[model samples]
Target: MTGSGHRALGLAAAALTVTGAVLVGTGVLPPATPPAPPQAVEASHPSRGRTPETGSRSAAPVLPRSEPRRLDVPRIGVHVPLSRLGLNADGTVQVPPVDRPEQAGWYARGYTPGERGAAVILGHVDGDGRRGVFHDLGRLRRGDTVSVTRADGSVATFVVQSVEQVPKSRFPSQRVYGPLDHAGLRLVTCGGGFDRQTGHYRDNVIVYARLA
Candidate 1:
């Protein structure tokens, strides 16, 4: 897609996914100097596609306010602790440390998981020449489960409804981040192909899930 077409969605998704850092930062491990492989890209791209229809009944009941502490995706073999992330000085969502690519982060400014709005989580695909958290995110399928442990020692489970890949230029911000009538989850990662010149990905992979 042309840069012009991606500008708006790019900015919106960037505001929430920290895509600018992926485009410019070197994917090197902290306290080390070795240059990371070119393919070690962050999982972030501006993207949006059709929103999945919400079912009347959810498998899990929505809980009250609680911060997420851990995330587990059995299908992807992901079991990682989560850090709370806020916005940067530039007003974009703050991302997990690049050196600690194995970790994932939750957007603290938005609704907590199991609430009535869409909860967002982000992770890197690869860095420091190794697989990063969410590297297998694209492998998740409908009906797969994502479990998030909250601060209250409660586990809120979400079932995948759909997975989509859309170009950054066509990112559907409203569909992705807009208010939801039910508790929802969105997992975002960089996909498609890497753009060597821009040091970014051409598309984003989003996994939509509802409380179950």
Candidate 2:
């Protein structure tokens, strides 16, 4: 999907949901506070500007787009099947069920794995007081590899370009979800310090990767 279209679709809801979860996890908010409605979490962070993907390093040529079936990040010991996620009635991106926090999900409406754009994979940091699939996502570093297996039996490999933790309020939406020249990957989860009063993590950890 075009960057603008993605923004219009469910980006707002996705951002909100991510931020809300982080806040709730840190206990920054009341435990009684209900999770954002199904349509409440896509793209809670708005990106008004765009950043060009630039670097001396170049990723492999783009591969055909395909539905991702599984993900493997050896460094973090993650090997989980992927579920398709679409937008909710309110236009927020769909999220993996909280009850199955160990699973990861892909934004099916957006770029597919190996396509010429940024493919987003989201997972919870924690749920039910246990670690979620992406609990260690922040520990990844540049040069780490993330592999995604597609239904076609092809594996797309991505090399981590950068890993950053930024305040949810200052999330770099354009940079993270914006269109890219190559097949890019974005792994996201909550990070930073937990706010005792609010019950939310103050920051988000994003891992930027490109096809390899």
Instruction: List the candidates' TM-scores in order.
Output: 0.78, 0.78
lDDT of 2 at 15: 59
Candidate 2 local lDDT, 131-212, one digit each (tens) = 6788788677778899999988999999887776666777776677666788888887776666666666766667778888
Clashing pairs in 1: 6-169, 43-190, 44-190, 46-168, 48-172, 59-212, 60-212
**lDDT, candidate 1, 1-212, per-residue tens:** 23542343344454744453362134433232222222333223323243674577545367898999999999889999999877667766677776777889887777788987778898876666666787777778789999999999999999998776666665556666666778889887666666666656666667889988
- Candidate 2 TM-score versus the reference: 0.78
Candidate 1 at residue 74, lDDT?
99
Q: Give the lowest summed-lDDT range of ten residues in model 2.
A: 33-42
